[model samples]
Target: MMRRRLLYWITALGLGTLILASTGYAQTLSQQVLNLLARTNTWTADQTFDNLTITGVCTGCGGAGGGTVTSVAMTVAPAAIFDIGGTPIVGAGTLALSLDTQANNLAFMGPNGGGPSVPA
Candidate 1:
């Protein structure tokens, strides 16, 4: 009886762990934005995302002397709302924006443009 009970407990524990491990959890919109902002490397490929809510202001993303250029090519889904700087706006198709802090300039790039205005 003791051995049978121990086997049953072990089986139950194994099954529970398996179930938990197999379950997938999706990241929240806030988490996704946080992850994107945390990225330090340049993205070579394009990325697609659903609705994005960008809150708060970036104090010093351009580093010291403001000579940093960050390039991103991302497509927001159709009918998705983008909340930037507390302003909510609905956009269709791709939305690309490049920020060049070295020159203190920002540009909105459309499709078929000569890449971003920022120096590579």
Candidate 2:
């Protein structure tokens, strides 16, 4: 009974909020958050990536179109070090990314340490 009441209240609140949305209001925050990939900015630099670990969802064949079944997987890897020209690009940075692919603003990049020495 309590669960039903809570659901009822939630539904009602959602409906009320939707109805009360003013015409003057623009895009919703939830819509923007869902559009992260759409909003990603493309970045390109002489990025020497090391100690890199990328995190993102991967979809496999399944669901309505039947195929091999499997669970969600999490992958990890160790960091590395390398050089780009005279500038030693060490640690993970956004060099692999192209400014066209990533649609986000090119914000400030943190200093990952660059010297003549590239750590082994």
lDDT of 1: 0.31
Task: Please give, for residues 1-120, the per-residue lDDT of candidate 2 as tens digits.
Answer: 455432111100111111112232323234333233224343222212232111221122135765653333222232122222222234433333112333357453646674466779
- Considering only N, C-alpha and C atoms within 3 Å, which residue pairs clash in candidate 1? none
The top-ranked prediction according to lDDT is 1
Instruction: Tell me the deviation in Å of residue 62 in model 1.
Output: 42
Using TM-score, give the best candidate's number: 2
Mind sharing the TM-score for model 2?
0.13
lDDT of each: 0.31, 0.27
Across residues 3-27, which tens digit of lDDT does each residue of candidate 1 receive?
5432111101111111111223222
Total clashes in model 1, counting residue pairs 3 or more apart in sequence or in different chains = 0
Those runs of model 2 whose alpha carbons end farther than 4 Å from true positions after fitting are 1-69, 79-110, 116-120
Per-prediction backbone clash count? 0, 12
